[model samples]
Target: MRIARMHLNESPFKPSRLVSSHVSKYVDKLNLYHVEELEAEFLKKLSSYTKLPRESISLYPGSSEALIALVRFCRSRALKLVSIWPSFHGFVEFANMEGVGVDFVYLTPESFELDLAKLTAVGSRSKALYLANPNNPTSNILFQDKDTLDFLSSRFGLVIVDEAYFEFSGYTAADGVLDYDNLVVVRTFSKAFSLAGARVGYVLTNQELSEEIGRYTALFSVSTTSLASALGALEDIDYMMEIVKKVIELREELKRDVEKLGLYALNSKTNFLFIKTPTLGRVLARSLSEKGIKIRAYNDRLIENYIRVSVSSREDNLRFTEALAALLRERSTVG
Candidate 1:
């Protein structure tokens, strides 16, 4: 039997065969020998796209590799990794995976905000702090909060901001790179570009650290295929933005759908929604699975019973809701 599956988190939806057609000529023009031009074009396009310094961007095979390298750099520099709880699991996972201890300051879900005063208390003893701009599960990004941004910029040895979902949020802390060497922005083609399979991502920082991280890394961190496709993805900003608009709109609609189930969704700027469930999150997840839907559930001591759902096209969206709605109706009847 085919098991029903729905990934209720932000991942690229499958693209049509025509997905790359939008940037055919752009990819066709690349010559592998002219590596400088390829790198230049990548930065030129990114610089134009994000208005970040052209020299500050460094490409990696994927965000995971970029993240691993960045975290390793902090440890090598004798800096402890600091993190905000409820960001991306990778931050803590990687730290322990690398055999280092990371201090995590848990944010209260009720406020859904950073506790900078507490972070300030814990930060000086720590070396680096990692956060997602619009964090993974809760999708609460607060860099615009002067207290959080100022505390981060002024004090930490490094603040790694994962902006993997920035396309949906329309925000960036990249400008801080010019002012502080401590700012490192990590991003990928996975979410916004529909290029997850391409394995393209970049870490944005001043030239010195980019050079440092690159010094001991693999020769071909990112493949030529990703390079070709990423350049293609960049040229199709119009198509990308069109999809982003639909995602944002659908996010609001899904929020309404979730709320109707007596579940409230966190305000999300990403394509996915973070929903607080009545059961340990999976109770509802399994209920929906039985009805032919799949969603992700998180098991954290801090926020138990939370799930992350990916936003897809209207048809997929409705399918997910229909399955979930059926599950809810059954529970109500049983009650």
Candidate 2:
């Protein structure tokens, strides 16, 4: 049987040729401590790529670590965290570990869109809000414009926007960090840049907040190879976009294919699609696993009957589509 691991939201593409070359050149530096110059260079490249001021951005091993740091900050300050339900589970889990309280604003059932009104009603009472634009498991962009930023800006709390899928969605809150003192944007190179193993991510906010967060950033957390690879990825933006283009093409094809199988494949701006199954998601996940295909199964109340699959290469997508079609046909005939 063919094996397809589509559960993790990792890019099917590898890092750019330039990135590989850069990492190869630095292979000998594995034993030495990571230096500040490479970190500075990567940040410079990031600032140029994002058009944000250098001082406003801080790098981390990955967005998860950055999020952990933010959660610690929130915990220390007794900041009440608010987020959309069924979003990324990391921060909520971290908050739980820290014993900080979190308020969840549920999404609309059918559209899976953010309940801005409900969020607004609760925003003033919370201290920080986490908005995962192009949210995970749902794969939908909450807004096309800066409406989210504007909405949260009018409220009292700080806003943390996680744009881990930014390259695929092209919607970002990085610039909003400049416009709103209370806004912070977190991003990762793992998805589009194809550096999941390297574990590189960044946070963008005002200079004061950046410095405040800097105090929590551990020294030498990022390795030298990771820094060089990130720099190379930044230098070859076109290569990354090309891979993103291919992923988008395959993602649309997969959406249509899954819909043909009678599943509700949500429109996605990210490199994955969320499919609502006719039966329980875990049951469907088991059936797919029997065919040597893996997908993310959700158990949360809002997404209990849905499965999320990362968009893979053309061949892998075709294999998954075929396997799913066969499985659905068999189930229909059995019924």
* Best model per TM-score: 2
Candidate 1: segments with Cα more than 4 A from true spot:
1-36, 145-147
Winner by lDDT: 2
Kindly report which residue pairs in candidate 2 clash with one another.
Answer: none
lDDT minimum window of 10 residues, candidate 1 = 10-19
Candidate 1, residues 1-335, lDDT tens digits: the string is 34344463545455433446633634554455335666677779988887777778888888888888887888889888888887788777877888888778888656568876777787763478888888887876656654566678777878888999888888888777777778888998888777888888898888888788766357766755567678877877877887788778888987898898788788888878888866677787777677666777766766676877888766667777777777778777888
Show the colliding residue pairs in model 1: 8-308, 8-309, 8-310, 9-309, 9-310, 280-305, 281-305
| TM-score attained by model 2 | 0.95
Per-residue lDDT tens digits of candidate 2, residues 31-138?
889766777778888998889989998889999989888887876666788888778887788778767778888989879998878877887734788879889878
RMSD of each: 2.8, 1.5
**Model 1: how far residue 26 lies from native, Å:** 9.9
lDDT of each: 0.76, 0.85
Question: Over the full model, what C-alpha lDDT does candidate 1 score relative to the true structure?
Answer: 0.76
